[model samples]
Target: MLKAKVGGALPAANEAMMQRAEAAIGDLRQNFKAWLEEEVGKLEALMRTARTSGIEGEAGEALFTCAHDLRGLGSTYEFPIITRIAASLSKLIETPEQRAAAPVALVDAHVGAIRAAILQNVRNDTDPIGKALAEELETRVTKLVGERS
Candidate 1:
């Protein structure tokens, strides 16, 4: 009798099942893109409200939460540049004190970066314009946060 080796290879039937499952999951990309677009719109709205109403209290917290969520989802949806922009914004408004004292201009800069990245279809971090935009936003945010401290 032949003995099956542990942790060697998947059986033929198991491999075929895995391939079929992968193909089925691949078809969900379009649906995921649609959902991501809707989520981004909601995030944009939240940011606008924070900008107009002043970044404080519930509005500020909501904006921060949205940015954080975007940061996590950006790479998953093939938008690494968005991840970078959102990460910077999240850092800028991480603390309540930071949010309360955050300048409107700084907040607007972050929101604008996010909007531009999405609208321009900047999926890669290495894209020349995307790189510049991410760097500029990160630098400005870092400077502003430093000044606050």
Candidate 2:
């Protein structure tokens, strides 16, 4: 039986490709701050709309979507603390029933924290203040939402 070629020249080519990929990612990193800011701005707009319309309708759903997107994008944007806080916010309003009962102040706090992190350059949990804020928000959200799946 004939076996497939193992790891010869392919490994070298793969290594070169990996290096190129890393360089591309590094290039993209420069734009991450602006991208993250745009996302946060959208989230803030959604928050305002949610406040005006109440959390039981379309605006609330949009707010949840914005938070979910921020949760997924935060780490990619070099803001892992944002990911943590956004995750907690996502959990707190994941469902309509939860949104109906979710405190506007709590949602406002999460958004405010995200804005503060950006403004203060607190990108991750390594920062003491960022860590404390993320932990507190997560704790509060868990108490209300009973942990997210």
**Top lDDT hit:** 2
Global lDDT for candidate 2? Answer: 0.91
Report the Cα lDDT for residue 117, model 1: 73
- TM-score of each model, in listed order: 0.77, 0.87
| Candidate 2 lDDT by residue in tens digits, 1-149 | 12345534333357788899988888999899899999999999999888888888999999999999999999988899999999999999999999998999999999999999999999999999999999998888888879555
Which segments of model 2 are wrong by more than 4 Å?
1-16
Each prediction's RMSD to truth: 5.8, 3.7
Per residue, candidate 1 scores C-alpha lDDT tens digits across 33-107 of 776787688877887787677778888888889889988988877788878888888889988998987786877
User: What is each predicted model's overall lDDT from 0 to 1?
Assistant: 0.80, 0.91
Candidate with maximal TM-score:
2
- Stretch of 10 with least lDDT, candidate 1: 1-10
